[model samples]
Target: MLPSVTFLAKFSPAHRRTITASAIHLTPWQPSSPQAEHASLSMMADKCKSMDQLKQIHAQMIVTSRIHDTFAASRLLNFCALSASGDLNYALKLLEHTPMPNLFMWNTVIIAQASSSSPFEGLLLYADMRRRGVVPGKHTFPFVLKACSNMKSVRCCEQVHAHVFKFGLDSDLHVVSGLVRGYSVSGGIGDARRVFDELGNRNLSIWTTMICGCAQNDSAEEAIRLFDGMIADGFEPNEVILCSVLSACAQSACLVLGEQIHEYIEEKGMELDVILGTALVNMLLRTDHWLKQNSAFMD
Candidate 1:
């Protein structure tokens, strides 16, 4: 296994997940290209434990004129932008200084910005990328849309959705999921459902996204309807979807369906963590109140 990510605390949990996943694909510096000193230095940036070591490597690359190699420059940019101890400002400066920043460099910085506290900056960066005539690939939209989701900007969500279709990335599941979330959070449930339905094939995650979107938007009937559809499609509901549907049931006072879901949870031996447990309790409370009212009125 690769070295433990010692600098994890410096980033948000989202960025930490991005870094951890990248570690598997990131190879150590290859020293075999003896004639290409820059290749060896680029590898060092991947293994850089701290900013000081990274700076030392950067200085060496500049002194050797290896900074001109876009690939070499990208390694330094990646470390600064995404690594825990490294600096985002420095990474931004490096990209600004580079004459031609590649797609990977754009993605690294965008991901960092998307998960950062100031996610709006991510949207600005994406706009700058487009202004520079850089066409975004599949990896780009998710982060861009994430920034939109964080800001809860309905206009921004619609704008991003336009780009998704313009680039023919509307079918990409990750990007689609981001759209569902962005639209949902911004109170654009109709748009969210439209996007969800347009997809020819949907995954469990997309289904969950649509259901949660409906539930959160006060479309309890739609949320419960979708949940039943999901089951018919052979998708097993996970904890998140269950919680969302339970919220829907609570809103609609769906006593029979709510009880059925509770039984299903028990049958599946699902753990009742805080979120799931709270959703369950809320559903029961609401339904029970309805029951008591109906019984009292009958008398």
Candidate 2:
């Protein structure tokens, strides 16, 4: 009988590896009907709550000559690369083995790597994809752009921005938003503002991106200005935007503005999320201290 998942979890890391290797070696299989084959493989993929189970299932795929099946491979890749429980190295190895991976496979890997701790891998994958002459789709650019944002790679970001324009994805909201965020995170606040201004009708996310970007890059005054403009334009502040403006208020020690924002939060019935709550508390404390010192000097 196959060892249960609970049993595998109890094993030491070294013991788990040995068990995985043994399971792969002992498992024998013949090609079943196509539908049945995919069903079985997919079932295994979905039930992969641990890395060991994934390895054994992958070994089964190799033995059954189903490794080349893009659907099956993609499912396995999704578990290993994208899911929090899986390993990026294993996913990369799987992709390397596939002979001339199609667009779906390439995009899947890029998307997974972009959101991983090592976002630079996604940027590298984009370059590799271009070298391989793989045509990028709309879905492709956002993932790459997000990687740019995470890496704060303004140079790569500008190059990707040009690519977005070249591919006529300049009008895509997701692509534009990614570019705005990328530029902002890279300390290119002017470039981010340029992107924002170019948009004919700005959404709340676009406003929030610019505001938060300013706040993050130590341009708290600019963040406040953007927040005021966001309100003037009639956009209701969400928790994210509120936290950002509140942060700016705290940094600049703008007590009146902070109090106004606190009132806005109460009037709007917005929840005080941890970030917002912290920002508000800090602002109140700082403002109180400033007032007390000024009064003491007068006395």
Candidate 3:
């Protein structure tokens, strides 16, 4: 129901003039007061209800010579790019107008788009950044890799994987985890495994991604094997890891293993929230069904 960027742009000329006319109102402000300036912008950004409001504020900032204020711009862009009050299109428009967007701006937009319904836009933004000769930071790869994961685009993921190595982020925990997830979703489990094997001090997220990826991609037995290795390697399983292992148990009809997991949950006092509860309950139901079918056959 919010206005689109194109729709909002139609009124920019009028809004710009209105802001320019009121430029004298902001003359009392001093650039020496960075904290006060940030506070004022933050409060205004927090109160913004629509793209028009944001554009109006942006216009005012321009007239007040605060156009290049990174903090103010970040707050505004974060609202536009990530919050419900704004649109991705508007966020993109804002970025397009920025004379030189910093890495934080790029990362924010990339993350917002990747997490949006149309995730492919994040990849396009990444391409745009590359064409502009912007060097991607450590935070940049994970979000774009997430876009690759969401689209299940193996070719795109492969290109990003190469970029990871090129940028010397191959060993970065979050980047490697993203690569593992991207490969897993793209049905390149072998590549995912290769990346997993190369990790020296594997974290819970990396292990969870590989296990969940295997469970979802028809490698349930491998998931179980990895779960065992995770425990043996001293990584305590979280609810997410347990849920994935439970799913693998359900797929394999391994009642013994499922029961062990249930006992482990009790031992660890892990909360059985909706997701983990559903996984455990489904595992139990599937195991019982398999047992009944087997017993029926024997009878």
Q: Output the number of the lDDT-best candidate.
A: 1
Backbone clashes (count) for model 1: 1
Better of 1 and 2 by TM-score: 1
Give the winner by TM-score: 2 or 3. Answer: 3
- What lDDT would each prediction earn against the true structure? 0.82, 0.79, 0.81
Name model 3 segments beyond 4 Å from true: 1-39, 46-49, 289-299
Kindly list the per-residue Cα lDDT of model 2 for residues 112-165, writing each as its tens digit.
Answer: 888888899998998898998988888899899888888888998899999988
**Can you list the residue pairs that collide in candidate 1?**
29-43
Candidate 3 lDDT (Cα, whole model)? 0.81
Best TM-score goes to which candidate?
Answer: 3
Alpha carbon lDDT at 265, candidate 1: 84
Residue 280, candidate 1: Cα error in Å is 1.7
Please, what are the lDDT tens digits per residue for candidate 3 over residues 1-299?
32244543455554644543354243333435756655776677767777767766776566544657766777778888988878777777778878888888899999998888888999999999999999998899999999998898989999999999999999899999999999999999989999999989888899999999999898989999999999999998888888999999998987789888887987787776778877887887876656533432343
TM-scores for all candidates? 0.81, 0.80, 0.82
Q: Candidate 2: lDDT of 164? A: 89
Root-mean-square deviation of every model = 10.0, 7.7, 6.2
**Sort by TM-score, best first: what order?**
3, 1, 2
